[model samples]
Target chain A: MTQLVRVQSFSVSSDGFGSGEGQSLERPFGSLDPADLHAWAFATASWVGRREPGGSRGLDDYFSRDFSNGIGAEIMGRNKFGPQRGPWQDLSWQGWWGDDPPFHTPVFVLTHHLRPSFSLTDTTFHFLDASPEEALATAKQAANGGDVRIGGGVATVREFLAAGLVDVLHIAVVPITAGRGERLWDSPDELLDRYHLEKVPSVSGVVHHLFWRD
Target chain B: MTQLVRVQSFSVSSDGFGSGEGQSLERPFGSLDPADLHAWAFATASWVGRREPGGSRGLDDYFSRDFSNGIGAEIMGRNKFGPQRGPWQDLSWQGWWGDDPPFHTPVFVLTHHLRPSFSLTDTTFHFLDASPEEALATAKQAANGGDVRIGGGVATVREFLAAGLVDVLHIAVVPITAGRGERLWDSPDELLDRYHLEKVPSVSGVVHHLFWRD
Candidate 1:
């Protein structure tokens, strides 16, 4: 079985900013609110967290539900791991997701400041100081027979994309524009040369742009 | 009846660029190809100059057909009018279009260097050195109770939008990204605070984003 690397349900603003500018401890997505970008998922019946029983069910919901299917290992950037830059000031700060976090499998956090592997719930985050190719190889190995997910923060995804490592991508475009931030692409058409794209619009105001290696 | 100021059937790339960078006699849309940005409209049955009888008829065609409906005057930037800037090197240059232009109404060309009004078929080209508000007022007067259209070249549309002079807009979102050029909005969400938006996707890979002032 082929081990695929996928970007699933990654949300970006219309201008192609996955997150906003000025990312800090308070704002993981920088100047942009994660809620604004991930509203489609949050409103879906299949989302990970639901305080109540009521939520939407449709195409948006299906993508939300399909986010973690056949994903054994995940790879992400250090910025996505936390806001602390340069040699991790606070070792006590585990991650943004506390207690029982998401991601039941092993996760490789690509960072220059390497640290000992830590566990939160079923997700064990291993700090890896390696290139995109190196990280993906490690992730694929950790995945066993399952597929690997290139979880993002903008730069991480860009690195993977630029390296031509990602196999499939499901990019969710929220109508809102962060106006400032790291952009995945100036235009989604930038990937047309390498990837076949299909844009599907959901009634919830989010356009799901699906891309696969051509 | 109220004289509405509308931005009709304006085409933009996925990343929000209406035209490409680097303008010249050869490329009207700067570095971007006008054909790439306007492929959807050109394929429509209502397009101004389609060579063949067979063209797609649906929402995309409807918007193309309604491009000039009830429009009596058009306000455009000098760049949209011609390539010659500063002093108008050649008066005989006329325009990129042949003897007959797409716009049948009186066209107001916003320029720093004003020239005498000239005619090409029914479309009279009147050069005006005026502010966006000033240009709208002149166009409104010329409209003679009919609606005035805000013809674009990025800067002109941005000017009118910034000035809060535009009423209704039917902006076409083509799937391709221009990568470089003049942008309409950093994100469509930026306008949600002022306008109600409805994104309707067509069968022919074009998403029509309709906006009306709130």
Candidate 2:
């Protein structure tokens, strides 16, 4: 009964360095305020740990609470799952998290390299050596009745979108613009009709935009 | 002395809601693992604030060290600067940062709204009513020979790259792939020649790629 319901995406100022200026191995997130990189901010532990607080409620908080609900399984590309050095050697990396990664369900990792499956706490990392379609099929199986989440780097997301597999997309259009970096939706103007803008108004000036394939 | 550099980019997951599942104002950062999300890890105060510590020295540490160098100004789109709630109310929403922000230098915010200048610390927020070209000119002037960092959401970066105005772009090439959402390089592949891959290696497993536009 698993269904691919939505694909949420937001852009990053790759600079490979992280966030914005002064980007390097040290400040990987860049020099901009963490709040500005709201897309990546949701992945931080500090942000996750504060959600349970009893005294918080606002527009920002509202979006945060809504995004995390009902995720059956997560899918991502190799680059998103770090070490950045190259082919994973022993799978010892286990990601940046220690023993318990935040993704506590079945997480499928898309890669060209094949490696043994790894698991921790409530999450299990399944390395798939197949195309996005194959990966989706496996994720659907694991999702049981939940929706499949498409994790991304850029290339992987494009593959799925080009094939018209994504159902719903939410983009937290942050206010900042990196003058130089990667191009998102660098698609021609003719492709504009492929998706429709569902929402734009949100708190803190962050435009919560949703696009769905027509 | 305006020069062009390469810029790289990728995507992050936000679900249909702007924030990830389980995010709240109290815990705005989200479910990010410090390890998997290496970029943010190097960015935390625990790591970036370590220039005072003279003992650390690894490839990661080296890049981190180089990141703290001198820079003059930051340029970001209106979406990256704050939310899209339209116009300024009393400026109560300074940003997602709590009090002291990260950028101490002058910051140029591109927007169509006419609002008074908002200055904080060494960072003077100037809202540009003109086009991206005009904003870049103003930012370069403020840079004073320093690098003009392009802060972004996505469209902003694409606009600048399309104009051929960047100098260096480093893309972290995260391994994850979102089947949908936004893309980093959805533009014409012909523009690939505009940038040359300066460096490509793995940091922990994450491929650190540097693209320089010559």
Local distance difference test scores for all models: 0.83, 0.54
User: Model 1, A72: alpha-carbon shift in Å?
Assistant: 0.8
Candidate 1: which pairs clash? A21-A31, B21-B31
RMSD of each: 20.2, 22.8
lDDT per residue for candidate 2 within B120-170, as digits (tens), equals 666677778777678888887887776577765456777887777776554
What digit string (tens of lDDT, one per residue) describes model 2 on residues A62-119?
Answer: 3343344456788887755653445767656676545777667798888777678788
Q: Which ten residues in a row have the lowest lDDT in candidate 2 chain A?
A: A53-62
Estimate, for each residue in B143-175, the C-alpha lDDT of model 1 and write its tens digit: 888889999988888899899998778888999
Q: Say which candidate scores most in TM-score.
A: 1
Q: Residue B15 in candidate 2 has what lDDT?
A: 20
Runs off by more than 4 Å, candidate 1: B1-214
TM-score of chain B of each: 0.97, 0.73
